[model samples]
Target: MSNELSVDNLVTGYGKQEIVHDISVSARPGQITCIFGPNGSGKSTVVKAIAGLLPAWSGRITLGNTELTGLPVHAMVRNGIVMMPQGGGVFPRFTVMENLRMGGYALDNKQVVEDRIEALIADYPNLQRRRNTAAGSLSGGEQMMVAIARALVTDPEFVMLDEPSAGLSPALVHETMERVVSLKERGVGVIMVEQNIREALPVADSVYIFAGGKRKFAGTQKDIRDDNHLMSIYMGGD
Candidate 1:
């Protein structure tokens, strides 16, 4: 199976207003693909469209041979596609362990769910240590960890994250980005929508830059870094 998530000629928006236009991007297993742009550039809209939270007006979204164009959120999860939204994804009132359990709610086998939770806890010692704490009580980085760990309980093939570094401390941002890199190491395709370009570029294998609801540049980290003009545009410089 070719573990590649491809988005072809996608167009979507809210109400009668269109935001994304003919956007095509792809993420391969064991690599990170980042989508970044100025505010109102439709980066998050594209993510939502691919995640099935927002319907696409026109496009084809495929993971390997599976078509994911119109699948609902639950159906997308069952197909090994999980999206963790910005801020935090945990149930604030729930305990850390409970939140993790909720992530595997689609699974029928209780034992399998428990086993996955155990594996996640073992891999993330902080989760094991704070298993009893409410998700709302943890630090921003810890909460993000729980969110990502929760997504892993289902063993998703493609994981999409939005603005993970927002409001995190410098150290926490580094830790969070490291965890994102670990996802690639585990052979899962990662699609990230980030405004933290400095932190995100190092981990990205490919990048797509959007402006005014259109893609302005699509290339590697080196391509973006070496181009002074692109950097000027990206940094809002004259």
Candidate 2:
């Protein structure tokens, strides 16, 4: 079985209207694959489709040979494909530990859940300090950290993050991107949809650029950096 997560000829949309037009992308273990486009370019739609929140009109999503196209969200979690949706979607009323526990909801073994949560907290000292605090009470960056920690509880092989750097100060954006890089360092394949081209490019191992619901570019960071026209269009225009 291949370790890479591959999306081939993906075509998906809302209600009969196609937003993403035959887009294909892939991510390998321990690498960061970033999808970037302007607003209304169908970046998030691709993520939602891969995460099983939306149905694929056509195409295939696979982890190695395992087809992930129609799997339910919980089933995807079980397959080590966890998605942290846009804006760090955390249950505001829930305590930090409670939120982490929710990430392990798909796991059948209670001991495994507890062990993973404990290990995550150990790795994130901030989570240890705020374990009992309500998620909403935490700062924005802190909440992002909580969201990441919760996702990690599943011990996912590949994580899909939508707009991870959204709604943050420049400094916090850098910190958040660092956390994302750390995920790659831990051998987790990361598929990130981001708007901050400046920040996203630095960490991106590979990039896919979309416009009008269609992919316009796909290559390494250097490929993007070398293309003066693309840099002007996405970086200057975005």
Candidate 3:
């Protein structure tokens, strides 16, 4: 099976108000696909639709050959697609270990879930040290770590992060982006919705720029770099 997630001409929004209009993008395993734009450009809406949180008004979302347009969130997890919403989306009252285990709730085997949690905690020493501590008690950066680790417990082929840098300090933003890039190194395709153009540009293998609910550009990193006009308009260039 192909390890690619494709969204073709997706149009979705809350209630009857359309926020995204005919936008399409794709991501491959081991690549970082950054969906970038300023606030209110509908970046998060697209991510939500792809993650099955919002139903597409008109489009097809597929994982390789498998149709995923209308599947529930849990169904998407089983399809190897996991989404980490903005603000880390951790269960504050749950312990760090418990949060990670929740990521694997769709799996039928408890042993598999426990084993994955153990491996993730071992890999992230901070999580290992605070395994029993409530996730809400950890620092912002640490909570982001928990969220990423929890998303990984499912061993997803595609991980979609909604503004992983939001509300983080400059240092923590850098740290979070580093962790996002690491997912590509692990052969997991990463679709990150970000407003920080500078931070997302460096790590993005493929780029999609949205404005007013429309995709203005979709190309490789080098293509985006070479477009001086686009840079001036979006990146505050000369």
Candidate 4:
């Protein structure tokens, strides 16, 4: 598959301490390509650079045909790349509906934004049930649903989520993973950072493991499953 987003010779870090070494990666259209590794493995840092949350020390990041390196977060969003950082970024004091409205600000077409919000609520019924509730009142998993929905309000083509399943219960985690799988059916490209390798592997079209600031492995999910021993060596035994 070709790439919707591509990064070449990428290097980034904070205050002179490089966290990501020269790395090349790609996310193909209509697929879930995941980044997995233990903490501080440069997964989030590389993602932040791609999402325009951090400055790229060196490298090229291209989304579609446009260059994204050194662009601000808003610029990235304008390019149809929206990121939902870890913690969901929900507004504690705001109602679910209000939050959705804020997310749709970029859409000047009121009917379109409303239609998108309704579609999201329909997809996640739990969110529909709590449409008028304050975001802080919802449980962690529910909050995650809201966050993803808010990101979708922009009608983004590429959505990058950081540690999406972090605080959810087992059932909620499964549901969230299912949602990731479903994104491609909606024609959205997803790049996610996940700690739960076992769950993510089943849905990923292709997977990439980042270790020591470099890509340790990149292949189809079936390829990894075919060689169980290979996964343990490359993925650190889950």
Q: Which regions of candidate 2 fall more than 4 Å away from where they truly are? A: 225-227, 231-238
Alpha-carbon RMSD, candidate 4: 2.7
Error of 2 at 236 (Å): 13
TM-score of each: 0.94, 0.95, 0.94, 0.89
Which candidate, 1 or 2, has the higher lDDT?
2
C-alpha lDDT of residue 85 in model 4:
79
Residue pairs with clashing backbones, model 4: none
lDDT of 1 by residue, 1-238 (tens): 2478899999999999999989899888888999988999899999999889999899999988989999998888888888988965789999999999988987788799899999988988988999999999998888988998998888999899999888889898899899999998888889999998889989999988888788787889878656576666564443
What TM-score would you give candidate 3 relative to the actual structure? 0.94
Clashes of 4: 0
Write down the worst ten-residue block by lDDT for model 3: 229-238
What is candidate 2's lDDT per residue for 76-102, written digit by digit as tens?
Answer: 898888999888899999999999999
Candidate-wise lDDT, in order: 0.88, 0.89, 0.89, 0.84
Candidate 2 yields a Cα-based lDDT of 0.89
Runs with alpha carbons beyond 4 Å of true place in candidate 3: 226-228, 231-238
